[model samples]
Target: MNKFGVLSILMVLISVLMFFILRGPNADLPLIIIILGSLSLLGIIFAVISKKWLSGVIGVLSNGAVLVCVFFILLAYGIAG
Candidate 1:
């Protein structure tokens, strides 16, 4: 697969896996944020490891997807609370 596809898979997997594995409304929430943060960092690393602009494109798109997810999460929180 291309870099973008791989990156998307990685971040989405982390999001889903973390939610199921760390399901609690206490410390697990912040810990999950940290995990997502790490995935964002990995996106940067992947971009840098590439020899051309393609990797950068993948990183930007992947990070954008994660950000979109985080936005939805915040929206849910605002609505719920």
Candidate 2:
């Protein structure tokens, strides 16, 4: 797997784990979401730079998933408004 793919997978795993671990009544939730979003954004950039079709696709999808998760997390936390 390429670096982008690895990063994407890692981001996905971290976001999923964090979502469960920090689900409710957490003080660090926003900070975690920001960090995860930043990582996901970086993964997307690296995927675009890699220029490998499969890796780029996988990275984009996985990182996008994390971003989506972040959004939902914000919603659940009532912090997005």
Candidate 3:
């Protein structure tokens, strides 16, 4: 895989780890959410620019999943709506 692909995968892993870490109380939820959003957005961009098909697709899916989960989590807390 290329540099972008590696970066994309790294972002994916970080986002997932952050998502789980933010699940607890008193964890600065809003800031964590924003960070996660930005990280996933970066992952998506890296994935789009990646030259490898496998990494590109995996990065897109993983990052997209994080974004969707974050959206729903915000909605559940009435923070998005």
Candidate 4:
């Protein structure tokens, strides 16, 4: 596999880990978002540099999904507050 492929795999693994980590009541929203966002950005960058179009698309979709989840979490927190 190429560098982009490796990066894409790593990003997916990290995102999964973050998801599990963020499941607790004491989880930090901003921290989780930042970590996931960084991983997604790196994935996209690697995909672009390596000319891996499919990985690039997957990176975008995964990032968008994570962002959406974060958005809803924040929204719910705001409403509850």
Winning model by TM-score? 3
Rank candidates by TM-score, best first.
Answer: 3, 2, 4, 1
**Model 2 RMSD, rounded to 1 decimal:** 2.6
Estimate the TM-score of every prediction.
Answer: 0.52, 0.71, 0.85, 0.69
Off by over 4 Å in 3: 79-81
Tell me the tens digit of each residue's lDDT in model 3 across 1-73.
8999999989989988887877776567677779899999999999999968999999999999989987877
Which of candidates 2 and 3 reaches a greater lDDT? 3
- The models' CA-based lDDT, in order, is 0.62, 0.76, 0.86, 0.69
How displaced is residue 54 in candidate 4, in Å? 3.3
Give the alpha carbon lDDT tens digit for every residue of 1-81 in model 1.
Answer: 466546645665676676678666653444555676667666656555553576566766666677566666656656765
Per-residue lDDT tens digits for candidate 4, residues 11-34, read 767877887877688877667767
Choose 1 or 2, whichever is better by lDDT: 2
- Whole-model lDDT, candidate 1? 0.62
Model 2, C-alpha of 72: deviation from truth (Å): 0.6
Count clashing residue pairs per candidate.
Answer: 0, 0, 0, 0
lDDT of 2: 0.76
